[model samples]
Target: MIRVLFYSAVSFLLTSLSCSAEQKRALEYTVSFEHRAAHYAEIQMVVPTPATGTIELMMPTWTPGSYLIREYARHVDHLHATSDGKAPLSIQKTSKNRWLVECPIGKDVRITYQLYCHEMSVRTNWVDRDMAVLNGAATFLTVAGAESTPHRIHFDVPEDWSRSMTSLVAVEGRDHTYVAENLDELIDSPVLCGNPVVQDFNAGGVPHVLATIGDSSLWDTAKAAADVQQIVARQQAFWGVVPYSRFKFLNVISETGGGLEHDNSTLVMTSRWNYRNKEKYEDWLSLVSHEFFHTWNVRRLRPVELTQYDYETENNTRSLWVAEGLTSYYEDLMLVRAGLIDQSAYLKRLSKSIEKLQTNPGRNVQSLSESSFDSWIKFYRPDENSSNSRVSYYVKGCVVGFLLDARIRELTNDARSLDDAMRLLYQRHSGPKGYSNSDFAAILSEVAGTDMNAWLAQHVETTDELDYQPALNWLGLRFAASKSEGTVAETKAATAPTNEAAREVKPAETDETPNDKREEPRAWIGIQTSDGSASVIITGVTHDSPAHEAGLNVDDEILAFNRYRVNSRTWRDQLTQLGIGETIDVLIARRGEIRTIEVKPVTEPTEKWNLKPVAEPSDEVKARLAKWLASQ
Candidate 1:
């Protein structure tokens, strides 16, 4: 009697399952590639249940990850609606990116449109005879009020294409069919279809796929996979959890080079032959690490201002340094932690950033927070005076990250570091509504168990010069300026041993020249040039320099120097052979007006900086140094 009851219950459950499956309406999208020859994609969206009063569809003006509004709807044309039985429905253009449809109630509606996709970018769509990359924001439309509705997508690939890849989950027992839970997820997932080489691996017990679109025969994809696996493992350990079950790394080999991060995947464009060179290969690895780290940073631990993205306009925030700059700091740091790069190489990269920040006059004009806020206008749109007026949040932010890590380590006595603070942010602020900059400062202080208000106010909120002393002193090192002309490392510090101290007060090798063998001092023109033109154009004249004092403005064409025809390629060499404090005749064409002037060149400024170790250090200093530079 119990067996008979169980059989009847199973039969009823099976019947109810079948009925539910039959009742669920299918929301399907079909993308056709037959018309790709004209750079057009035919997209048809089928809605099983039509709305009663009015139905509105919208194409996003821009995509996430990339902040600019590209107006994706401009590429759409020939859009019309029809009933499931092929009866035409009336449609009207409501806005720049919106379309309205008027149809009878309780009828199925199918909207068909054509997209002209020739722009080749990570955020846009590109279709050719060889391959097709479809970004959801540029290809799909959403029902105005039904953004959370589930979507089903099908691709009609070309005959030559062998496979398709995306991060979205695939439908059961279906070929090239995927499902997205909502409009945001659909836009976040990009589809690539072509005869590409794909390699799959498991990192931290999670599946990861690397897909290559262009020629990759020269690339050692196995080595890349191993390195990426290491990166994934280290990052997993850092955050203590992996958010996504499966991830994808989509690499498109082309002449252009860039990378964009997504929720569960990343798209990178690079040269086909980059793997052949060691430095280029390491750079590629750094790029991979940078984008992968974003999975936790900007994608989740974003600023409150960027918690909810606005697709139609600019979303401004004062915390991009935390987003992009801190990411920049970790790009190379992760490389070292993964054993892909050494400590020396990491320091070299850090010193390079220091040189950039120290040399660019813009650092004195723009604060780190202000630079982050004005990125949409000032950072992206730059002029010749940009170096003199604005600083990059990326460069300065990396420096700040370095300083903060060292300071935190000093305060916690190697028991904690910035890594701990980052983990706290990830655990507490990973939400749709993110924490603000003030909240971040507070969290940082709380994690480090110290007051960071003064540091944050001085370095981040204002344009005050950064003091590298705190960081360098902790490492038993000092910052010094270089006087050597060729090498970036001219290792003489302020307290460095002098000739007398080294030679036991033997002899002075000072600026004294033998009477018979006097050498001419080197001269500086202080004018940067642009080459490959009929006449050399002065690109810039340094402030308070001889060229600036002589009124040799930018864009002034140099006709001759010392009565000799001046070539931009040889001008620097000529100046090198001249003596300091010597006046030279210069013929220039200022705004098409020819004139001659005599200007005296002076000695060049010694501003190139270097990082050098201290001669003698305290035991506490040595211990701190070891703790800071210890193996990650």
Candidate 2:
């Protein structure tokens, strides 16, 4: 009897779910850009009502991928509701992001509102005379309890607008309509409308589109599409599977910056002139690679805390070090693997990341986990003391990923690495089920063939200094020697050949003089300054440095150094003339008052984070390095 009752209950649950899905399919949204020049998007949503005589409509407070409570409802204006028969209904504000509607039971309600879309960002909405970029979270309002229903959206493109683009599945036989499986899918897809230069390509047997939105006369669309194709193929090879049937790269060349990842598409903003410069173009490619990589890391195989998004509030997690940091580590590496850059370029980029992490004092104050957890409060909202109190999960995570990769290779006798661990983690916990920290550590242990929990704890959960020796040794790499006379051990370690067959690999010479050969160290005040109209303005004072100790503050305009007038161009040169330990009077304007502060110059810290190939490397080590960097 009990078994029969259980079967009956299952049958009833399935039937109810089917009915709910059917009811949700009734929800339809229509977006029109009637006032395109004024940057207002008219939104009309027809929602199916529940058995209750009242229903609530809500707008998300923030978008995913970009972490911040943006309060999207603030953009909504002049909202009204009406019954399906066109009869007016009473709507009242229930909360900041919700609206209560009194409607007839079992009747569909039509909600109409105007959204101000002047914010030009990847996660928000922007509409002008020429173009429109709409993010779902910042544009749509859905019925409260019917979020799981299929949401169909129709775009009423302006008559002059050429086209509209989105990753949402198109409705058959409809002019400009698309359908989403649920609210999550709706929010994950962004729409771009205008006459964009569309370049289509295929990767891993899947269709992909690159829609460039701004001026294209100077942009190389063909070359960019081809490079992006290479990135897609390489990343697909790394993951060994193509998760999305079709993908889109929404490249808005609107003189902006940033990229937000979606499941089947990515919205990236950049300047129209980025393609002209080699370094700037490479940076754009890296941004593309970073966001595309998220198709697997954060968009799918995300931290359990982020597995289910709470759009109204912060969804905190301690594993962004893996989601964002590991992704950062692989972004540039994947670029090299895709043949977009050479090993030297890759090494230079990696060296910069190492330099950034090593030079940051906050690395000693904040752990990787803490950095990830406090990102909502600290990372996005930065202040003057941020550098002294916090570290970027992205930078530190990238360094740790490098070290972890090398350690895994060492533990497994060069047979396995972090790549293997990531693949395994994805295989086990890809869909709705997300992995925890212990699960990730266990995967790493399995791949490395050893216990890695303690190491992981030390690097992720505590503020312990990271040991870079193991990775350097495994890859036959070392940091470049500085002039401070303390890099002898490093130089010897890099130059000492172990056997007759070992080849000596000297550091590449550049135009700059060798640090060790310089006559004297440069003087530093340790205060970053910006150019003001009349004087140099101090932007930031390094913690515990000479400038900080001298009671110098940020925003102070420096009128003179050592009683001599100085401008932005001559301030650094004048400061450099001062000898170390020499006390100098700095004249500054503090909120319109003149003051003089005595500051002693100090020897600038040596640059010890530049990475280079070891001076001596065995054939085995060279082979390992080759394998690590070789194209897949």
Candidate 3:
């Protein structure tokens, strides 16, 4: 009798523990797309009520990676709540994204709402007759205090929709149901409900799915998928680890642009016709490489500031330069290393980034750290003067990354590169407890065998002009000569030869006539104009330019230049005909009032920043370059 009683008690304890586990996952959601044609998704949630007699629900204000407050609650309509007995419960809006509901104690509560999801971006939700792309942050509302608890979602896909795809773990014996370990996993996983062209491949012994929607038979799906596998293999080799069990690349060929990274998957949108063009297709591949690199950079090894995300409000960080900029730097490099693009193509792409940074006047105003911190306000919300005041962390950070990589190579005599530093950082801090700015510098210092804190601070914290001499010399590369008389400061710095071998190499010339050979300098009005139906509207005026000095404001209609009638098509040509240092009458219409402003055109600044290898590189330099660009 004693043994029998002991066995019965142990069984009872095990049953109680199982019941407790089930209760933690008692929240169930059913999403139906009955009105998808109208771009509506109906959501039904069932929650197990606590003994407190009240519960709060919250819809996330913004999704991760986008860094903008989208106010997802604005799309919710016809929200209602009820008790287990079907009795109506009192529901009140406590905040813009929160709802308070009163229900019977120790009972279950049912809540239903309709969401209108028509936004076409990767961060938001979109549903039409043909398909539905749903982001969890914009689609589901969670019980406020129960975010750590498991949540199950069931998709009642439409009859015409073939299947649903996501990175979430599927529930066994259920047709379209999936479970999330926690709210974070649910939000990180995006779902696609449609008949997308699915392709499967394995890299690093891990399964990957490439699902392309809206193909329309225009995309080279097979080749794209094969190339994507190569990218995956290259990136995995770089990291030396495959972090996830499986991965998915949710490609949407919706004639759109942009991509958002997730933990185990990514959503990338592009036009179907991009595959036919070599440059555009390579650009799409670059996009893929960028988002994939984030799996190791931001998604896992992140800054301390972004270690824990606050979904309700802005999560500020001064390390987006490292997160996004480093990713930007590696995106194209990865493509070359994967053998998808040749070395020439890679250099061309890198040169464009350098050119963009050199031309943007904001590089002198905002430091990379400031750009990362103020991305919520200044980066996303740009005005006419943004170009003069705000720099892109992605651009400057990428340039800085290139210089940093070269600096490391120089310090260690090519014995160690930035790749070692990244791997070391990942080994030390790729977890919930992220590293600080100083921590990142320490890693670089360790790899380079020298302290880099001061160097890092000067580049990240101050808006100081970057010195490109080290990178140019170490890489045995030079900037192509400018067509205009006054080349930018960086061009002058790059022109200095590294060795006697470099002296034998003739500087690469642009397609335009040389500055000394040209008959006249190119005249610049310094205004970017848009072609309106009836007039040429000034959209932007460069800072300290002739247009800005003459008070040429944005939105001013330029009816003519030098009193000669000119539209947007003819304005530039006519402006070019005018002599530099000569003031000409530019007629304008401000708010329908006819006016004329005198403006002096100056010689256009040289903006060429093309990078090319030295024509006569020494054997040593050639070997270094090979090591830098070779596949891992």
Off by over 4 Å in 3: 1-23, 483-520, 531-534
Cα deviation of 154, candidate 1, in Å: 1.7
State every prediction's TM-score relative to the real structure. Answer: 0.85, 0.91, 0.92
Which sections of candidate 2 miss by over 4 Å? 1-23, 482-520, 531-534
Q: Candidate 2's residue-wise lDDT over 494-531, tens digit each?
A: 32222311111111111144446766776676777664
Off by over 4 Å in 1: 1-27, 85-91, 479-557, 578-605, 610-626, 629-632
Error of 3 at 413 (Å): 0.3
Clashes of each: 0, 1, 0
User: Candidate 2 vs candidate 3: which has greater TM-score?
Assistant: 3
Model 3, residue pairs in steric clash: none
Task: Tell me the lDDT of candidate 2.
Answer: 0.84
Task: List pairs with backbone clashes in candidate 2.
Answer: 505-615
What are the candidates' C-alpha RMSDs?
Answer: 8.4, 7.1, 7.3
lDDT of each: 0.76, 0.84, 0.84
lDDT of 3 by residue, 1-632 (tens): 00111212334544543465475745789999889989999999998766688999999999888878889999999999989848999999999999999988888999999999898989999999889999999999999978777778999998888989998877667888987767898999999999999999988867899999876488878889999999998888888877777789999888888999999899999998899989999999999999999988999999999888888999999999999999999999999999999999999999878766766668778999999999999998888777778889988899999999999999999999999999899889998989899899999999999999989999899987778878887887878775453433434336432332221111111223444456656677677666445568877777777888899999998888777898755776687787788999999899889899999987665544678786677899888888888735
Error of 3 at 373 (Å): 0.7
- Worst lDDT run of 10 residues, candidate 2, spans 501-510
